[model samples]
Target: MKNPTNGSLAQTFQTLEEYNPALNAGVEKVALVLQTMALFFLIVLFIIELQNYAKKLNSDDGGLTMEIVTSIGMRYLVAFLMVMASGEILDFIMWLAIQASKWVSSVLPEGTYNMTVPGIKGKVGFFEKPIVFLFSAIAQLAVWTNSYIATIIIFLRAIQLFIFKALAPIFVVFVMSEELKSIGIGFLKQFSAYALQGVVLVLLMGIYPALMQNDFLAGDVATGMDAWLTNIGVFFLIFLKALVVLVLIIGSQNLAKRLIGGG
Candidate 1:
């Protein structure tokens, strides 16, 4: 009997497939490289935007404030685009890994079976109608018929750092004109940033590889892009998470020093 406490992860661990030598390494390498490039570019772009923003805000140029606002909005837009692109790339990689595992399993000396991928997407349910109103109140009233694009644009404009910088910290003062307090400001900032992160990733996780049919990583099996998807399974993703953690730890220390004034 399986323990409920062990959770789906236990199943995942138990089910890790052993694939053909050529397919496994090939898919993994391709996934790893593509994922690494995407993450690397995201970090690099974030840093670039941050520096540019710091300059625009602290500069005396008359147009600096406007430039900063535009830049921030566009950063979100670009970030959203990149995130969407990455998802397609990931799907391609995963699909390849699964197919390779299937092909390899069919020909295994011992004869293997039981291959499955764990992914679940719940569609709109009857009970979810009430939530539509909640989202709609916050969501944009789009003029364009392409609701997705409008939502993305509206969200970018409304939730970006520059807009939040102006909006999140208002405080009522009896002594003088009102001032904005920084209380709860950190939460708001993080929430908006994370919201953007989720949407970006969701978009990328679906459509990326369609853009590059030849992008799969199965080198041994690929004569053309038919082998573009990878075979690494989830190990490459595990490695990427470690990289993000390392980066966050180092970046947090630097960020803390900057905020509170000390290294």
Candidate 2:
């Protein structure tokens, strides 16, 4: 049997990008039905807007002018086009975000130190310094747990992107009315934030290596007890650093949201 954990982080992300549960046949059919219903409602909204314009024309306000009609018609037309191409637009946004993240990672300085549990284990002798070995093992576990959590968050974000893609048509209908345009704009902002989460993750990953490059416990220890104490302190510091990185990775979505002015 194939081991699920054998996949690298990059492979996991690639899989997530390719996965599209929102495009399931049943979901697509449901979205189409909802889109049809929303289009009908859009038509009703446009008619109501025209009626308002007519009333204004009868009044001294002169809001029933050609410019107003043209604006309303344009809004409805744009909304219609958006609803039709919602999936493609969302896909493009996601692709753009992934590409941006890859570019950022490519530009960042690569770290020389091995931050993995196995890497740490290889550095210390298991039998000679059992206490230090224990610390390294614990650090390894912590690193693995942190990585797993980050992967889960990224996977969920991918799912959210697809869900947004599937529902874009309905939310975009709000753009047809001036009063409800903010709702549509808010949806787009939220989607953009989620899409940008990958970029935040890439940045954190790129920076983490540099932060962990220096070995605080590099020198030889004078005594066994002293070595144990020193290794323990170093391990504690390592844990603190790893914890900070993990927290940032988990909160990447919120960070992205703030970056894009999304609530």
Candidate 3:
């Protein structure tokens, strides 16, 4: 009755606070390493291509027309600019997705409720206290699940940001070469879908809370057991949807390739 979850719940939340930041920092370090490698590979590939192009230009059928030369220069210039502004561009795109998500959530019903015992200082019976405590714990579990989902959304967006930033040059080169253009288009499709994942997750998170709120209100008036069971069911559904979002994001690259006629 007197804060049944005092030690364990405090420890759990404390652990979350300590580890989430560590996990985020570690992921960023790994992302930076990968981004460096991607940049290196792009440079190597560009140099090799440039040499080959020079040899071709010196041949009898060589020498690019002003139009072709200008087009190629412009394409590389675009690629250069994109790579330089990749971070800002990515941030802007992510901001837009978050804004869209906020707009959608604004239209949905609010999903807020309280699940706690009130005035329990020698007022309620000892037996009733434990029961209320149990319900309160369950409600807290629901709250934790929501926070976990939000953490996942942040992690996913971090990953997408890394991918886009690391491959900004590659994406730009897609416009320069006909052979690699489809691959680039596929990459763009993949990027767009990945960005939308945040929106999808935001919307999904909103929906479950509303349903839980309805069930919670009804269950309070109806029966504690009913509300508990229904809330659990709804949270399970939310977990499953979260898994599906992860799968879709992971498999999006191949799907994008297929969609853009790339083998």
Candidate 2 steric clashes: 0
> Alpha carbon lDDT of residue 95, candidate 3?
59
> In candidate 3, what are the lDDT values of residues 1-263, reduced to their tens digit?
01112222122122111325665455445445554554554555555656566678878577756675566656656655555554455546555655665566567554322222121122334445566456445555545555554565456555555556555544644544444667656665565555555555445444544544433343332244444344444445444544554455345445534544453
Best by TM-score: 2
> What's the C-alpha lDDT at position 196 in model 2?
84
Q: Estimate TM-scores for all models.
A: 0.19, 0.82, 0.51
RMSD of 3: 9.6
Clashes (backbone N, CA, C under 3 Å), per candidate, total: 16, 0, 0
Worst 10 residues of 1 by lDDT: 169-178
On the 0 to 100 scale, the lDDT of residue 45 in model 3 is 50
What tens-digit string does per-residue lDDT give for candidate 1 at 120-229? 11233444434533333222221111223323433342233232222222210101111222333343334334223322322222122222222222124422322212
The CA lDDT of each predicted structure is 0.33, 0.69, 0.48
Candidates arranged by TM-score, highest first: 2, 3, 1
- Candidate 1 residue 176 C-alpha distance from true site, Å: 42
